[model samples]
Structures are given as C-alpha cells and as structure tokens.
Target: MIAVGRIFRIQQELDCVALYFDRFESFSSTQVTSQVGLSYDSRISRLQWTDFAEAIPKLCCKTLADIPLIDDSAYVRELLQHAVMDDLLGPANGPNELIKDMSVRDRYLVGKLAPRETLDEGNDWGNSAVDEAEDVVPDDLEVKAKPAPPTAGKRTKGGEQPKDDEALGKGEPETSDEIDVSKNQSLVPSSFGITFCVDGEAERIEVEARWGRYERIHDHGITKTRKNKNKKTGKEEEIEVKVWQRIPCGGKMVLDLKQGPVSRRSPD
Candidate 1:
C-alpha cells in the first residue's frame, strides 16, 4: 500500500497558503518483500511541491487573518516540525518508514494508484476546463443601443399608418392612443454630472447631449379649469382640469468598460 502525507505552509506576504502531498510506500507484507530486491532511489519527488512554493508569492489573499485559524489538534503542528527536522538530518535508505506507517488506511486500501501519465493528462483537462469557465470579454466590445420608440404621429416612408390588425379587431387602435399621450405629456430638461471610483480615485464625468432625453411628468398644482354644460340639466359647471407638463429632469449615463464612461444629454 502507498500512503500520502499532506504539508501546508502559510505565506503571509502573498496572503496565500500552499498545500503539498508526499507519497511513500506503506510497510505491508507485500511492500516489505518488494523492497528487499528493489534498489534505493535517492532522488526526491519534490517537483510539484517546489512548483507550488514558487507560485505562493504571486497568490492573493483577502482573508482577515494572515494564517487560517483551524483546530490545532487535528493538524498536529508537531508532526510537521518533526518531518522538517528529519529531512534536515539525512536521507534515509528509503522513504520515511514511520510516516508511511501512520498513513490513512482507507486511501490505499483499494491498492490502485494513479499513473503519472494519467495525472498529467488530468491537469491539462483541468486547465482547459478553467479557461472555458472564465468569462472573457473583448476590449473593443460595444453595447448595442436599444432601438428608439417610433415617433408619435409620424408616417412611415410610404406615408402609411403602421397597423396592428390583431389589436384593431379588438377595437383598440394602439398607435393613436400612444401618439395622443406622447403629444399631450410635458417634458422637463435636466442635466447632471456622474461620479465614479476609478483605481481608488474619484472620477467625475460630464454628461453628453446625445444620451439625454426629456422626461414627461405631471405636477401637483392646478394648471387650468374648464366649463362644461350638462346635457340633461342644461346647466354650465366649472370643473378642475389636470394638465400634463414637461419638467427638467436629470439625464441618464451609462458606464461602459470597453468605452470607459459614456454620457448622454436629456432631449429638450
């Protein structure tokens, strides 16, 4: 059976922790008999661990604490200390026998080990999967503006009224009502500058005229009154009339990553 031991190191400067695994042969009857005739391989398989340590400096950590706070009883920091001391002492005839003996039984119980070729192929597949999962946007990407609403009371190029036969059959002509409302509503002019935080600094952007539009709105005050004669009583009565007025409202601006900041002035 083969046993695996995990080692972890917290890199405070990079705010990242690195974990590595060391594999050694377990002291089973089969392993003992096989080792008697096998030659000792002194070269250590620390390539993956060395690569991980090299990558630690470039990692970013956003956690509140420099080191993770976990239960010390489970990790047993003394084991790591002893392992380091043993490595510094000298190379053994083979992998550390004590460490191999203490390996978790379940992981190697199946007696099947992953081949180095399979692991390398799996790493390539993993890298490709990560690339596919990433959301990549092009620098020159442009946002398509929404199509403008058809102008009220405006004819098409052929001077024909746009018809909705389905709506017309229901006695609800859409174009006329929309045109009347658009023409009756009042619009106010407004403009404002937008502020944003760029690279931890406040950036103020001016509003551009094209992106702005006048908003139609109604106010509380009475704008006018009307007198009407009752058909049945033949009496004239004064009635309060509600009026739609256009007021000046601030314009809209869009923040585009590809184009930086974009501003549009409200239409007059």
Candidate 2:
C-alpha cells in the first residue's frame, strides 16, 4: 500500500496532458522522434526526417523567374520554418488544429524540411559582405558625394558619372562603390545580399539536433494535473499524464561529404 501510494503521489507531480476528444492538440514533440514521419517524397512514402536533397534531383525541375538573391540566412530560415500546411486556429484558448493534421502529406513533408542547404557560395557572399565593405571605405573613411559630372557640358576628367551611378540621384547617400557586385550582374541595385546555400545533410542534421531528450521546437511541455470528467469512471477526478507520440517513417539517408557537419574539405 505504501509503494502504490508513493507511485501515485509521484505521478501527480509530473506533467501530463489530458487526451480529450474533439481537441486538436499540438503534436507531442516529446513523443516524436527521428524514427517516424515521411521521407523520399514518393507521394506515398513518409519519413520522420525526409531527405529532400536526394529526392529533388530525381524529379524534373524547372526554373521560373529568378530572384536576384534568396536574400540571406534569416530569409531562407523563415521560408523553411513557415512552410507548413496551415494554422487551423480555433477559439482563442483552444488547441491549434492545423499543426499535426497533415491532410496533404506531401506538402507536409516538403514544407517540414524546405529541403535546402547552407551553400558555400552563400556563406562566401555573407563573409564577403563584411570583407568587401571594408575595401569600399573612402581613403579618408567618409563617403562624400563626388560633384556630379560638371552639369553635362563636354565630359571632364572624373566628372563623367556613368548613367548607372545612382549616387548622382538627388538625396541618395550611398554610392555604387559601396554595394556588392555579383559576377554576372548586368544591373545593380542599391542594396547587397550576404547569403549562401547549404546541402541536404546539413539541413537534416539541424532538424534532428536536440531541443531536449525527446522534445523539439520551443520547449518541453509539462502539464499540471487537473480535475476533469473521466470517461471510464463516469465521475469528476484529477488526472495527469505525459504522452509521447510519433508516426513511423522511412527514407534513404546519404551524406554529402563536401558539406555540412561532416565535411573534410571545403571548396576553394
């Protein structure tokens, strides 16, 4: 009797969630693992950690319009993080439904991974932003506007501003020299980009990194016991329980030796 009573007492203090019907609960990160979910994107197959880097090339791909840049690391991270099915919001205090309800499994898998990388080129661009900016500082360390080419008379030495130099534009403080120039760029913009692409393995590694023993996302969710109607007992009682849930998943895991945490050498 003492041992049984002690067990109950201990459980009463630990966190647990009430599994109520009709409540769309957030997926239990504690219950989830890398062993479940979908991978390979076979449209029929699912994995806990999908290897999109390996899968995209097998499918026919096409480029639509090109963005001047993917922006930067934060932008890419945002694009990956928010690529989910839906919010499926409920009453303010109620559970969120869209979180785990992957009606469209394919979208869910790809959206979960965004299946992209931390490219060497992008990293170089980011580093170069800092490096190149140093070189662009004026000889005296202040960027004073060079007087506009002598108001369009016969072109004078150093006064012939190119049509593309927006520094000549009224009220513009930055000059073209201060901006980054892409190798193949024909047209220049006022701002620059510092970003690179990475490989699939790096991304996958990032997803599997521990938020905790079994928890992912923000933090571990521990619940306090609460009084509720017990279906089995048909009476009001205090109940508390912790649950870990995971769906089974499968995919071929490969490694990109040239990139990610496993790389032996980086591109020169």
Candidate 3:
C-alpha cells in the first residue's frame, strides 16, 4: 500500500503539467478572459504552474538533469531527481529499473532514507562556511591608501559648486511680481479661485494681495483726464494732467542766537 501511494502521487504530479498548459492557453488572452467573465485574481491562481514552467526555459536547460524541481515532499523530490538523472545518462535504455522496482515499504522498514531535517540548520552551515573562507586572507597584505581631500578653487569630479561662495557671483535683482508669478505657475489656477477666458468669453475673477512685515505695496505712477473750458474761447476741451503735492519741512530752519535786531523793513 505504501508503494502504491508513492506511484499514485507521482502520477498526480505528472498530470499537473497538462492542467497547467490548459490554463496558460486560456488566460493568455485578455479579450478571452473578459468574454468568459473571469476576474484577474481568479485567473492568476489558475495559471501559477505556467509561471514555474516559464522559469525553466530562462535557465537555459539542455537536458532533464538541468531541470530544477522544488517539491515539498522528500519522496517526490528523490523520485523526480532519479528519473531525470537516468534519462540524461541513458536516454535509449528507458527508465531505471532499480528505482522502478524498489518498494517504498521495504525502504522505510530498512531505514535506507533518513528522516528529513529542517532547512534552517543547512542554511546556517552554508553562511558559516562562507564567513570562514573569507577570513582566510593574509594579515600581512598591504591595504590601499585613502584618497586625499579636495583643494580649494578646483571643481569636484561631479561638477558641484562650493557652498561657501554661492553669493560671490553677480545676479539680477528679483521683483515681487516675478517671484509671486513663478511660485503659482505649477498649480492649477482654478484651485486658487481663479478662472480663464474660453471661446472669447470674458471671465471675472477677484484676487487679494497679502504682504509680510518687510514687504510693501509699490505705487506706480497714476494718470487722470478731465474736461476744462478754454480761457479765451469759452469752449470745453479735454485736458490730460498729472498732479502731486509736497509738504514743507520744519527741520530745515536754523536759529541765530547772537544777533540783535531793532529795525523792521517795509514790504517791497
């Protein structure tokens, strides 16, 4: 019965190949899956075997011996490994009779196959072996010298500028309007309560300006127009004018403390 179970499980593993191929051909087309009404996740689970098969081709396997099998069962892995080795060694002579005729019951009773151990021990041993091999270098070997520091006034290999001299070069003065325009260029204008004209239709928008403590509103010159009567003809005509006022400064006066005045001059 034990021998029979092993053979049955081996046959089931072989049958998985055909099942996987069918799924690969089915879900390979996006239009077909949509027409057949299958969700993407459901289709993915059905085609996992295909992924394993595709990985084998990338390994450039030339013979059955080159194929890799990652099976959970130790018995299944041993059976597959023996079958592949036999095929590569003697392709003309069919399957190895030794493996085919062996009884799983007799093997278990005689303890020919040891119990499987956890993979953690094997992995730790491999890491320790690598560390031991790397430590074998001679201690007397000379080590390479470290690189020298970069000199001043010389550019680095990456062409990065020095941080200490960023303001050494002359640059154009920046205005408040230019700075504000550049900061808002990347954002969507609609989010800022702004609108744009479309198809020759005008759009009305209102904007508020805010200033920090060191910032002030600049006053550009203003112009105004008014209608006036001509002095001689008594005819009204439009005249353009610009106007501004100046205030007297009280600080400009200087007092003469030592002078004594007794005469007053008449107005001339």
lDDT of 1 by residue, 1-268 (tens): 4333333432221223344333212222323312333223463433444544333323322212233444455455654664463344211111211212112121122221121222244532122111211111122222233444544476568987656543223332333211111112222111234465565343544434321111222343433323567778788755533322222223445444444554543332
Model 2 regions lying over 4 Å from their true place: 1-213, 216-233, 243-268
Which order, best to worst by lDDT? 1, 2, 3
**lDDT by residue (tens digit), candidate 2, 1-268:** 0000001111110124322121111222332222332134353444332443332222312111111333457745644443321222111112211122112222122222111212355533232222233322223434456544433344437877445434434444545544233321332222332445666546342211111011112232544445667779777764333322222222333444354465432221
TM-score of 3: 0.13
- Write one digit per residue (lDDT tens) for candidate 3, span 1-268: 0000011222122114211110111112223333433325652344344543443333332222343343447755665665564344321122211212222222122211111222354522122111221221223222333334444566656886554433323233332222121122232121222445434343322333221111111242443433557778787755433221211111122223333762432111
Instruction: Give the range where candidate 1 is weakest over 10 consecutive residues by summed lDDT.
Output: 128-137
RMSD of each candidate? 32.8, 27.1, 45.7
For candidate 1, the lDDT comes to 0.32
* Model 2 vs. true fold: TM: 0.14
- Which segments of candidate 1 are over 4 A away from where they belong? 1-37, 43-143, 156-268
- Worst 10-residue stretch by lDDT in candidate 3? 18-27
Best by TM-score: 1
Better of 1 and 3 by TM-score: 1
Candidate lDDT scores, in order, read 0.32, 0.30, 0.29
TM-score of each: 0.17, 0.14, 0.13
- Candidates 1 and 3: which is better by lDDT? 1
